[model samples]
Target: MSLYQTSPAVAEALAQGRPVVALESTIITHGMPWPQNLEMARTVEQTVRDAGAEPATIAVMDGTLYIGLTDDQLVALAQAQNVAKLSRADLAACMAMGGTGATTVAATMIAAAQAGIAVFATGGIGGVHKGAELSFDISADLPELAQTPVNVVAAGAKAILDIPKTLEVLETQGVPVIAVGQDALPAFWSRESGIKAPLRMDQPAQIAKAFAMRRALGLPGGQLIANPVPEADEIPADVMLPYITQATAEAEAKGITGKSVTPFLLQRIFELTDGRSLKTNIALVLNNARLAAQIAQELSALP
Candidate 1:
């Protein structure tokens, strides 16, 4: 059996050296409600195509690692229950056990690198949870960025996380967190985190060149392109802070830990915000998809 499977469109694109952006499946399987999740997945994929690249949504189904999903597969996975959330530690094990799984940022990067894909887009990355000093619950996504050579475009680390500590961990891991069109790192649903980014790039071509230069210098890690959510779609940081704090407090009080923390906080925030948070999330993800497509195009054009 082959180590991976690819949809016909993605396979053709890869064979022809066309631009392709890898998408994570956890956004579909674990990030949203059933029909909304499917709709978001479709929208993000179409966003990539509209920006002139193929979108390869990665997932594992019945023990098979699929580099891209068909339409039916997307629908099935969206409505599937009890799907494993796979990251670096459990991705292969999920496949080995013939279990269906959704790919998190770390797992998606691993699959993207394995399939020779150079770019990925998502709403946000996991990061140091608030109070991680004692909880020691840093996310796997940070270390994966330090080692995987796939450009991950996102609004930024999820605002629910400890943004300052997240940046510190990224810096310590040697991951280049480059804010696009600004110096301030974006705070997922908000455009500015008040934390100055260590690096900034104004254009996709500049990002592409940096990516190539890193490879030339034998750098093993990928870059994080922090694309801010469009202004009209964003909830100001001040407006979001209280909702985040309330949700975080709820999660802690409920004793939610491990993989359960993020989804729980997100759901609580969604409720606390009267559903506005989910809308902002969808907007940011689509925005990242467009930027990731542009970066992929530039990467493909490189010699």
Candidate 2:
């Protein structure tokens, strides 16, 4: 069985040594409702293309690791029910068992590295969850970044998580936490997280150089590029805090745990925000896609 399959556009780009950005499929399957998910996926891919790179959206379908999806495949995945949420732990096992799954940030990074693509774009990555000290419910995304050599571009850890603890964990693991165009780390739907980013890069090319230098120096892991949501699209951290706190309290009261916690909180927050969070999510994802493409282009230009 083929270990992976690349879409025609991605294959051609690889063959021609052009820039290619990998995208995770979980946002389509688990992050949003149907038609909007489909629309966002297409728009993100087009944004990368418009920025002079090919977009390779990775997923596992019927035991195949797809580096990119055809239009029909994308629609099918978006509308499909009960898609497995894949990560580093179960990616190959799911494929070996001929299961269908949507890739998360961690799984997408692994897939991108396997496919020789060095950059990935997503809305936000999972991190240390609230009450992690008690529940020990850290995200696989952190460990995946510790080992996978694929640079990830995102808004930040989802604002609903324990952002301070997330930063501390990243520090302990020595993962590069970079804020793009600012000194403050970004929260997913908000422009600021009120925490200082360990590093700041004002240019996409500079960020690309940092990735290249790490590789050249035989570094094991990749960098995290935290790009803030556009100001006009932001929900503002102060305004969002109360809603997140209330939603998190509800989760704790109901004993929501593991994978269910995030989606639950997100859905509750959505209801609380009257559906504005999803709109910001789509915008930030598109922004990350554009930046990831530029970084990929710069990497391609490097010796």
Candidate 3:
């Protein structure tokens, strides 16, 4: 039996050489509350479609890797409790145990590559946690981008992380971090992280050409397109900084570590911002989906 399965829409699109934008399922299962999560998932998928690309939302259900989900499956996943958040280290284990899992950036890239999808869109990528010098904690997403051949379009690393160190790690891994329409790296929820991006490409065709060029050169990894959140929806860096600092401090005081830290910080930030953070998250994800669809369309036009 094949380990992977694709929804009819995604399969048809792939077979027909059409543009398809891969989506991560963590946002549905772990990023938000029930009905809203389901709503967000549908909206994001539709956003990709509206941009002239098919959407493939990846996940693992009963040991089977689903390249895209059916409506019923999306509902079940949104309502499912305690779904394992799968990443590079435990994705296989979750599958072996027949557990349902939400794909993180790393796992999503792995799945997208396996399914031959060239682009993915997400709210943000995980990165070096604050105070990583002591915890030595870093997200596998960085290393995955260094090896996986999927172009990831995100608002940038989550604002709660150490954005500067994350960029350094990406640079060290020989990954291309391209900022779209701007020279500054976007800190998730904010339009600018204040650290200049190493590369900037204004057009989707430019990003597509870079991807093609990398493949032609036999580069192992994918590129990170740091698309900024729409300015109307962004929470300026200065306004977000204190909230992030407080949330990080709270997490540390509570001894929240590993995978728990991000969710905790996000929830706390949501509270601290009077629910504004979640709204910003949704806005940024939609922005990324739009850009990813454009990039996928360009890539599909390539030879």
Candidate 4:
């Protein structure tokens, strides 16, 4: 028996050598609430399709690594309670145990590479948490980018994280962090991180060329393309910083540690921001999906 399963849409696209954008499932399961998650999932997949590529939404269900989810599967995963959030550490373990899981950035990249999908789109990737020097609570997504060949597109590190430390860790791990259309790194929910991007690329074709060249040179990891949310949809960084600071402080006070920290912070920010953060998050994710599809198309057009 095959170790994985592929949906007909993805199988057809792959057979034709067509471009396909890999989407992480955690955005559906853990990123948003039920009906909204389903709505976002459908909208994102449609966004990719509209941008001229297939959308491969990855997850593990009943011991099968599904490269692309069918509509019913998408609905099931979105509404399922207590779905395991799988990362590099336990992706295989979940499969072996016949458990269902939504893939985080690290797990999604691994699944994308295994399926020969070269591009992934998400709202943001996890990064070094605040006070990582003491807790050392860094996310596996950083190291996964250092090794996985699938290019990931995101708004930036979640504003709730330590952005400078995340970038520093990625730099140390030899990951290419490219800001799209600007020199400033984008903060999730905001168009600017207030920190200059280490690298910048203005076009999808240019980004595609870099991805190809890295593969040609046998580079181990992939690129991080930081695509900012549309200005109309973004909240300024300054407006969000205080909320983030407050939320982070609250989490520390509550002793929220490990994997629970991000979700807890996000939920608090959602409340603090009067749900505006989630709206911006959805916008950025849609923007990223569109960009990732263009890159995938550019990649498919290449040799």
lDDT of each: 0.96, 0.94, 0.95, 0.95
- Distance from true location, Cα of 17 in model 4, Å: 0.6
How many backbone clashes can be found in candidate 4? 0
1-303: candidate 4 lDDT, tens digit per residue: 787888999999999999999999998988888898999999999999999999999999988999999999999998898899999999999999999999999999999999899999999999999899999999999999999998999999998999999999999999999999999999988999989999999999999999999999999999999999999999998999899999999999999999999999999999999999989888899999999999999999998
Clashes of 3: 0
Per-residue lDDT tens digits for candidate 2, residues 83-191, read 9999888998999999999999999999999889999999999999988989999999998888899999999999999999999998898799999999999999999
Q: Give each model's clash number.
A: 0, 0, 0, 0
* TM-score for candidate 2, residues paired by index: 0.98
Model 1 local distance difference test score? 0.96
lDDT tens per residue, model 3, 1-303: 777999999999999999999999999998888799999999999999999999999999988899999999999899999899999999989988999999999999999999899999999998898789999999999999999999999999998999999999999999999999999999989999999999999999999999999999999999999999999999999999999999999999999999999999999999999999999999999999999999999999999
**Model 2, position 211: C-alpha lDDT score:** 91
**TM-score for all models, in order of appearance:** 0.99, 0.98, 0.99, 0.99
Task: Compare candidates 2 and 4 on lDDT and give the better one.
Answer: 4
Give the per-residue Cα lDDT of candidate 1 at 113.
96
Better of 2 and 3 by TM-score: 3
- Cα RMSD, model 4: 0.7
Residue 283 C-alpha lDDT in model 3: 96
- Superposed by TM-score, candidate 4 places the C-alpha of residue 178 at a distance from the truth, in angstroms, of 0.5
Better of 1 and 2 by TM-score: 1
